[model samples]
Target: MSAGLLATSPGGDVLVAAIVVPVIGILLLWLVRPRAVEWVALAALLANLGVAVAVLRTVSSSAAPVAYLIGGWQPPLGLALRADGIAAVFMAMAATVLVPVAIYARGAFGAPGERRPMVFWTMLLAITAALNLIFCGQDLFNLYVALELLTFAAVPLVSLDGSRETLKAALRYLVFALAGSVLYLLGVAIIYGAYGTLDLIGLASIRGPDGALLLAIGVMTAGLAAKTALFPLHLWLPPAHAGAPPAASAVLSALVVKGSFFIALRLWFDLLPPERAVAGSTLLGVFGAAAVIIGSAMALRQARLKLLVAYSTVAQLGYLFLVFPLGLGSGAAPFESTAWTAGALQLMAHAFAKAAMFMAAGLVYEAIGHDRIAEFRGLGRIAPLTVLTMTLASISLMGLPPSGGFSAKWLMLTAAFGEGAWWWVLVIAAGGLLAAGYVFRILVPAFTPPEEPIARVKPVVVRREAAALALAVIAILIGFLPLAPWPLLAIGRIAAGAP
Candidate 1:
C-alpha cells in the first residue's frame, strides 16, 4: 500500500469514542447496582453501534483511512487509531454478534444483580471494547494491550459457572495464553530493539527481510497462531468454549478468536514486505490445510454436540490461513486481490454462523439437559426454533448457496484456479465436504422421533431463540454481497502510490 494514502482525517474523534465508550461502562459498572449493568451495557453497545456505523459511513464516503494521531503527534512519538474499510466492517460484525448475545444472555443468565450475570455483562462489553481496539489499533504495542484485555476478559467468561471442571478449563486456557503472551512479548522486544519504534505504519516504512525481522515475525506468528487456535495449538479452545455459557461461547467462537487472527493479518498483509511474507504465508497455509483435514475428522469423532461445534471452529479458523497462500500465488497485491476479499467474507460469514450455532447448541443443552448426539433424536420436534436456527447456521458453515460461506468459498475457488493452484482447490473442496459430513452428523439424528415425549430441561425463552436466529440470518444475508472481487474492501486500502 502506498504511504501517501493514509493520514489523519476528519471524524477522528469517533475512533476515540469507539474505544472509550465501553471502557467508561467497565469503570461505571462498579458504581451501579448489578441489575443496572445489563441495561447500561446494552445501551452502550447500541450507542457504540451507532458510532461504528458513522465511522463506516465516513470511511466509505471519503474512500480513505479515517485516522487519528494521538495527542497531535505522529508515529515514533505518539499512538494512532485508524479505521479502514476492513476495520469498519469488523466493527459492525462485533456489534451485530454482541448486541444479540447480550439480549440472549438476559434470559440465559437469569436475574441481572447476581454475581455471575453482572460479571458476564461487564466482560461482554469489555470484549466489545477490546475487539474494536484490536481492529482499529495502529500501534503494535497498543494493540498488544488491547489483545491482553480481550484475553483476560475472555478467560473469566470461560469459567463463569464456577464449576470445578470449568475452573480447570479456565486454568488451562490461562496457562496456554500466558505462554503465548511470553512469545509475543519476546517478539515485540526484538522488533523494538531492531527498529526503535513499534508503530505498524512506521515499521512498514522501513521493513526488510533481515534476519532480526524474520526472527521477530516467526516468534510472533507462533504466539498468535496459538491464541487463534489454528491447529495443534487448539487444545484449550474446545474445553473453554464448550464449557462456557451459551452467550459467552458465542462471543468466544464468533469474535474473540478473530481478534488475534486480525492482528496476524495486519502483520503479514499490512506490515510485512512482500518478499518476506511469501515463505511465512505458505507455511501458514500448510498449517491451515492440516487443520482443516485433521480438525474435521476430530469433529466427526465427537459424541457431544458442543464439542463438535468447538472442533469445527478448529477447522473453520484454518480456512483463514489459506488466504496467505492464495493471496501470494498470482503476484497480485494481496490487499486488493480476490483472495483477500474472499478471506474477509469467510471471516464475517463464520462469525455469524458460528455464533448462532454455539447459541443454538446452548439452547439444545437447555432443552435436552445433555448434548450427547445419540440422545438428540426428536430435538427438532421438541425445540423446532432452536433446531431451525442450527440448520440455517449449518447451511452457512457447509458453504451452501445463498449463504456467505458459499460466496467465500466460491471466490476462493476462483482465485485458486486463476492462480493455477489446483492443490488448494482440492483442500477447499475436501474441507467443505468434511464440513458437510459433520453438520449432517448432528442434523440427521435430530430429525429422528424420540422414543417418548422429550422432557424440557428448562423454560424456553422466545427472545433467546430469536437472538440466535438473527445471527444465523445475518450469515445468510452476507451471501447477498456481490459474488466477485469486492471494491468495497478496497475503499480505504492502500495498494499503490495514488494509483
Candidate 2:
C-alpha cells in the first residue's frame, strides 16, 4: 500500500476500543475504591494492549491505513479516525511501556483506598486515551482536542506530592502548554481560512501554497516545539519531569512529550513537500544539536539521580530531530532512509531505557530515602536487581554495543556519512559521551563498597524491581532490529502532493 491508501478496513473498530476502554476506566475509577479501581484499570489496560496489537496486525497484514470516518462521512465536512502504520506502531509501543508502569505504580501508591493512588490511576488511563486519540486523529482540530486532554492529564501528575517545588513546576508546565495551545489554535484558524479544510488527508490534497499556508505551518511548528520542549523552550521540562512520582515521571518523559513531537512529524513528513521539508528539517536539526549539547551537559552536572535522568530526556529527545537532514538527503526516499528508521529506533529505545532508569532511580530513592548520587555507595549490594536494571538501561542510553541505542546511532552515522551530514555524526558521538558521564556519576558511587551496611528507608520490593527490569530488557531487545530499515514504517507513505 502506498500513501493515501486508507480504507474502511476490518478491525477498524479496535481503534475505538483502544481509546474508549481507558476513558471508561477513568470514569469508573471516580466511583470505586482503590482495589477495584486497580483491578479494573489493569484489566482495561490489558484489553487495550490486545486492541493495540490487533490494530498493528491488521495494518501490517493489509499494508493499508484503517480509516473510520465518523458516521461514514468523508473529510472536509466530517471528522475521521485513521490508523496508519506509524500510528499502529506507536500505539503498540505506548501500550507495551504502559503495562509495566501500571504494575510498578501499584506497588508505589499502595492499595486503592488512598486518595493519591485513585487520582494517579485516573490520570494514567486518561493519558492512555489521549495518546490513542492523538495517534488516530485524522483532522487537525480533532488532534488539538486530544492534545489539550493530554496536557491536562499530564500536568497534575507532576505535583502529585503537593510540595511547593513540584506545584511550581506543574504551574510552569501548564503556562507554557497553554501558550503553545493558543499559538496552535491561531494557526488552525489561519489554515482553515486559507485552505477551507482542517483534515490532514484533505490538506495534503492541496497543491500550491500561499503565504498564509506557510505562515500557518510555521506558527504551528513553533507552537509544537514549545510543547515538545525542544532545546531553548525546554525550561519547564527537567523540573516537572523530575519532580513527578516515578510512574508519572516515566509517563511524562517517555510518552507525553512524544505526543507533540509526533504531531510535528505528521506535519513535516506527511503534509509538507519534500523541498519545503528540507529547510524546516535543517532548522530543527540545528536546534536538536543544541539540545543534545546543552541538555547532556546539564545532565552531567546534576547531583541527584532523578534530575540527571530528567535532563537526559532533554538530550535524548534531540536525537529524534536529527532524522530530518539525514533522511532527506542522499537522494533516497525519506521513509526508506536509514536515518528515518534510526530515528524511530531512537524514540523507542529512549522510551524503554529511560523509563527503566527513572523507575530504578525511584527504587533507589525508596530504599535509601534520597537519590543523592554521592551518597549512593553500596546500592549495588543493597538492591542488586534495581542496580542491574540501572546498568542495563544506562548501557542502552549510552549507545553501548548490543543495545538499541547502539544500533540506532550506527544506522544514523551511516546515513550521515552517506549524505555528507557528518556534523550530526559528531554531535551524536558527543552526546553518547555525555550520557556516559552521567551514567558513571550514578554507577560509580552506587557500586562503591560501603563503610557499613546502609540503613534502608524500606525493604526493596521484588515485584517493583522485576517491573523495572522488564522495561530495561525490552530496550536491549530492540538491538535485534535489522540493521537495514524495516519496511513497516513505509507501509502507507505516498508521494508528496499526491491526492
- Cα lDDT over the full model 2: 0.87
> Which pairs clash inside model 1?
1-494
- In angstroms, the error of model 2 at 145 is 0.5
Clashes of 1: 1
Judge candidate 1 against the unseen true structure and give its global Cα lDDT, from 0 to 1: 0.87
Task: Compute each candidate's TM-score over C-alphas.
Answer: 0.97, 0.97
Worst 10 residues of 2 by lDDT: 1-10
lDDT per residue for candidate 1 within 1-499, as digits (tens), equals 5552245688888999999988887877777887677788888888888888888889888887789887888777888888888998888888878888888887467676787887888898889899999989988889888889999999999999999988998999888887877788888999999999888777777777688888987898899999999888989999998999989999999999999999888777776667677788888999999998888999999999988999999999999999999986669777678899999999999999999999999889888899999888898888899999999999999999999999999999999999998988999999999999999999998988888878888867889999999999999999998998776676655333322
At residue 377, candidate 1 shows an lDDT of 85
RMSD of 1: 1.7
TM match of model 2 to true structure = 0.97
